[model samples]
Target: MTTEQLKLRSMIVTALFAAIICVLAQLIIPLPLVPITGQTLAIGLAATILGARYGTISVLLYLVIGASGVPVFAEFSGGISKLIGPTGGFLVGFIPGTFIMGYYMEKTSFTFKNAMIANTIGMFIILAFGTTWLKISADLSWTAAFAGGFTPFIIVGLIKAALASWIGVLVRSRLVTAKLLLPIKPIVKEESI
Candidate 1:
């Protein structure tokens, strides 16, 4: 494909992933503090498939759209309030989390193992940001924040991490093979002759 074609394709894919994040964000299991949504899963999938640059772009697009009053957040909620709300930290965290997840895979290998590790790290990043923000935003103690924001999501987060890893690797491989996404280039070590 020409450079223009590649750029166009990348843009389209990025927008598609943003939409995917929006759709997945609506899948919610409500809780007292924050709802368990599929946003993380979608973020993981975006990183695994789109790599660092495009994946981060997709996440940013999603955030901008939601922040602009589009009802793309959890439970069809949106607007800047959703971002500045107690749970906003998690949404904001998605940017760096997605970037790091994709960067890890790009640096290592786009395999299931790497995806698991990257996604796991990404999950913690989100939780850490969210918990800290939750504590401040809600004027709650750290312990209370941990209990509501961090503790409750551990097991569920792990499950989503595993699912994202398994499904992501599979889908990424297929996309690469089909030319929908570029294949990961293996790192070659150079030795002094």
Candidate 2:
């Protein structure tokens, strides 16, 4: 296939995964000024399957949709108001998480240990941005913000990271073995005289 075709296919997958994540967000568990949802699992899956840049764009697209009154976020809220809400920091965090996971996955072996490390680091990046934004938006001190934004999800994030790593390793191995996913570079033809 042509490079353009490959790129288009990747984009389509990215969007599909993002939309799926949005749908998962609707299954919410309300907490104190926050909510728990399965969206991170989708984020993990997307980054694992799609790679970094495309994965990030996918999550950004999901954010845009949720921010536009799409009824796709956790707790069935939408529009820019959701973006500025208390949990907005976590919503915003999805972007970098997807990117970091996707990017690192591409360059590394899909071993369980390495993949888990990469996924964990990716989650940390997300939490860092999320907690920082939460502090600012909520007018809380750093410790308070971190407590509010990061504590509830710490265990869950670790769980999701391990799950994502497993999925990544399995999916990538199968795809490679089956020759299902196209390589990044086009094949070069040799001229034989």
Candidate 3:
């Protein structure tokens, strides 16, 4: 395939991953008032698979799609209103989170240990951005913002990060192996009768 075709294919893959993450974000874990979603898992996975640049682009596309009233955000909501809401910070944070994950994935990372380290960094970045933004946008104190935005999701985030890293590396390794094993076409020659 040509370079352009390869790039197109890469974008498509990134979009698909972002769409998957949006859908996954709607899967709410029941709680009293606030609920949790598996959104981070999708972000990390996309970044790990797509690498840094494509992963960031995929997340940006996801935000655009969600902001365009597509009902793809959590609870089937979308638009600018949601973009500026309390959860918006976390939503925005996903871009950097994905970037972090993809950055690590591109380096010397195949083992679960490396994945763990990479995902941890990604998760922390997401939390930092989300918490800080939450404080500024919502006009809440740092402690309160973290209490609302970060505390509830700690365990789940860790789990998601581990899962994304492990699964991503495993799949990437297999893909590499498959490509290495693919047979090359042999040229055929006809002899004169």
Q: Which candidate number maximizes lDDT?
A: 1
Candidate 3 lDDT, 53-96, residue by residue in tens: 87798889889999999988888889988768767877888887
What would the per-residue lDDT of candidate 2 be over residues 1-193, giving only the tens digit for each residue? 6667666766676778778888888877777756768888778877776677777887899999989898888877789987787778778888877887776777764577767877888788777877887888889897798777888878988998899888867876675455544443323567999
- Candidate 1 residue pairs in backbone clash: none
* Lowest-sum lDDT 10-residue window in model 2: 178-187
TM-score versus the correct structure, for each prediction: 0.96, 0.84, 0.83
> What's the lDDT for all of these models?
0.92, 0.77, 0.75
Estimate, for each residue in 1-193, the C-alpha lDDT of model 1 and write its tens digit. Answer: 7667666777788999999999999899999998899999999999988888999999999999999999999999889998889999999999999999999999899899999999999999999999999999999999999999999998999899999999999988887776677676757688999
Which candidate leads the pack in TM-score? 1
Which residue pairs of candidate 2 clash?
69-79
RMSD to truth, every model:
1.2, 5.0, 9.3
Off by over 4 Å in 2: 175-180, 184-193
